[model samples]
Target: MSSQSLEQRLLRAWYGKAAWLWLLRPLSALYCRVAARRRHAYLSGERDQWQPPVPLIVVGNITVGGTGKTPMVLWLIEFLRAQGYRVGVISRGYGAKPPHFPWMVSATDDPAVCGDEPSLLVRRCGVPLVIDPDRPAAARHLLASADVDLIISDDGLQHYALGRTVELVMLDHERGLGNARCLPEGPLREPAERLESVDLVVRNGAPGDSSNGFSMQLLPQTLINLATGERIAAVRWPGPRQVTAMAGIGNPQRFFRTLESLAFTFDTRIFPDHAHYDASILESLPGDRPVLMTEKDAVKCAGLAQVNWWYLSVEAHLSETFEAALLNLLSVPHSEKIEQE
Candidate 1:
């Protein structure tokens, strides 16, 4: 089966609780055991971890798919900057193929080389960013090259080699834990119990149980034309109500739901997460009606986008309580945090 098909099937099996998934339970059990041991090794100091001199906060998720992490990281960047902190970001740059490891990414950097999400983050905020598979190497490089007092490791919660002062885990409130199983049997990379260990947990939507975690809403801000640098409020989209919606994200349905929330009627087109796009692929998109996509996909389609193509820009909005709690935690001395850990 094609990778897209396989991913769809797995997503369905995972969230739908398909009985066939039971067949993968043994493998999932083994995967969980190995992952637990690896984490234990890091905690026990069997593995060397690079501890940065400055504070480092990790914004990541336990699940394998998107949980609005990019938006959360972006929100943190702006929030921290507003609080007078110079922040730098590090990412694994999944699917990126830069000429060298530990490459510094700029807003002008090609999304195809440094990956879409990193490219989008740097472009959106112009924050200093470094991309490398080795989280420690990326963190060191970011510190050495940028005059940043704080570092945000984008999606590096599981990278135990990079010591962090804070961990913020994001979860899709609707999906929760998807059977609460690890890997092949479900969507989680780590076990569901891992949530208990994170410094804070933020649900991407209103939590079913208000006391469980802080709630976050991805509020649509505006829509930017890809062909030209024109911007319009998303609520005032001037195109036909029935447009083509294309999303190459871990949760395309989430994007579609956002469109629905905006009162738009759209035909859907889904791609594998981080899938690259070209003129040929887009040329086959069925209609000349406005093509709407997520900002993550827009980064890759800028040069190839048609005049009618636009991307919805959304911002993460967390409650004031969450913000005060986060700042309070950061106010705690790093030494105290380490000692507590």
Candidate 2:
């Protein structure tokens, strides 16, 4: 089976109770034991941790699948910039294979080499970002090169070797912990109790367990035509359009649902998270149909401009109360923030 199909199957097993849930329990027990031990090793000082010179914010999810971490990171970056804080971003580039350990990403960099998300961030925010498996090392590189006052580790909550100043855990409200088992048995990377320790819990979509934290949502802004560079409102576009909605990210169905919410009628094409696209994939889709996609997919499809392609752009907006609370948690002086900028 193709990797995409395999993951879909795995997600099914991980998401809900099934026969396989019982089958995987033994392995899950072992996995959870190892996970707990590994975390304790770092927490107890058996393993050395690296701390960034500046305050570090971690944008991560405890669940296996995505919980809108990218949008939250983008929103955080924009919010920090508006607050006059110089921010840098670091991430473990999954699909990237750079010759060196720490690779600096630029707007013109190829997504195939630097990973799709990093390329998208460069194109979207134009901030200084580094991709390395050792996230703390990446942050160090960014600090050495730029005058950034703080760093954001895109998604490294489980990576205990990297010490963090603030931790914000993002969760998909629709899938809240998914059977609450770790690894092969279910979707969680760590126990569900891990949520209690994070500084803030960011829930995407409808009402969830919001007793302690707040909710955030992605507002679709506009769709950009990759071919002509034209912009159209996602909801206000006038057309009984036959388009192909494509997404090659974690939770492909989320993109489809968002498009449906915007009243777009289109066939769905879901690819594995971070799947590399080639000419063959484009050929498989119907001809002459406008293709709608997430901005992350657009970065990979930048060269495959053979079809009429457009990608949705979304702005993540947080509650005003949450905004004030987050700023207070960071506790940086307003005058210092302005001076850093």
Best by TM-score: 1
Which residue pairs of candidate 1 clash? none
- For model 2, how does the per-residue alpha-carbon lDDT over 1-341 read when each residue is reduced to its tens digit? 12366777677667765665878889989988998899989978999988766788999988877689999999999999999899999999888987786999988888988998888887899989999998878988888888899889999999999987788999888877878888888888888888887888988884533685578788899988887888988877765577888888888888888888888788788888898899987678666677888999889988887537889999887888888878886897534643543
CA lDDT of each candidate?
Answer: 0.89, 0.84
Best by lDDT: 1
Q: Estimate each model's TM-score.
A: 0.97, 0.93
* Root-mean-square deviation of candidate 2: 4.1
lDDT of 1 by residue, 197-286 (tens): 888999998743266789999999999999998999999977788988899898888999999999999888888999988876677675
lDDT score for residue 228 of model 2: 81
